[model samples]
Target: MQRTADRLLREPLDCYDDGAIEEGDLSVIRLALEQFHHAVADRRAVIGTGSTDIPPMQARQT
Candidate 1:
């Protein structure tokens, strides 16, 4: 999950630097934000499951 988050963060930066994503693209930003949220959720889930806190992956946005 941490690896996924790291990848999500890296992918956006890479795309921006490669000119694949425009600076003013809100869609791209939203997608990146969503991916980041997912990664965080996954990490939290892993921790929660390990410690038996809230049954794991129960934390969600919206």
Candidate 2:
């Protein structure tokens, strides 16, 4: 999960804010995502699960 996050940060993804996201803001987003995923993993680890099935984050195109 961490690897995927890192790759995503390195790749070019869209910013829904149009032009609101600046160069400096990327690090902040990256750090936040890292922390969030780490926390999720930690929480899942405590639950004695063989694997964690994280749901995909997608928006409905209705």
Candidate 3:
């Protein structure tokens, strides 16, 4: 899911014209991405540390 979100964000938006997207639809996309990343981060906060002995801060810094 995180990989999917990353790919979605990394994708080029220039393929679509500015006028092609409605303002409300753009907001929904932004909100979905925000929620997806947050959900991934929240899961990682728990899952990441348990699988490894590394501390969260230290693991991130490295």
* Highest lDDT scorer: 2
Cα TM-score of candidate 3: 0.49
Query: What do the candidate models score in CA lDDT, each in turn?
Result: 0.59, 0.60, 0.51
RMSD of each: 8.7, 9.2, 8.9
Question: Alpha-carbon error at 62 in model 1, in Å?
Answer: 22
Q: Report the candidate with higher TM-score, 1 versus 2.
A: 2
Clashing pairs for model 3 are none
Per-residue lDDT value at 10 in model 1: 69
In model 3, the runs with Cα more than 4 Å from the true position are 6-18, 49-62
lDDT of 3 by residue, 1-62 (tens): 75876677543333233445444555566667667656666777877743323323211121
Off by over 4 Å in 1: 1-24, 49-62
Q: Write one digit per residue (lDDT tens) for candidate 2, span 1-62.
A: 76877577644335524554565666676566757666776788898765555545443232
Query: Model 2 — TM-score against the truth?
Result: 0.48
**Candidate 2: how many backbone clashes?**
0
Question: In candidate 1, how many clashes are counted?
Answer: 0
Q: Candidate 3 local accuracy as lDDT?
A: 0.51
**Tens-digit lDDT track for model 1 on 1-62?**
64865676667666767888776753665566666566666777887844323322332222
Off by over 4 Å in 2: 1-17, 50-62
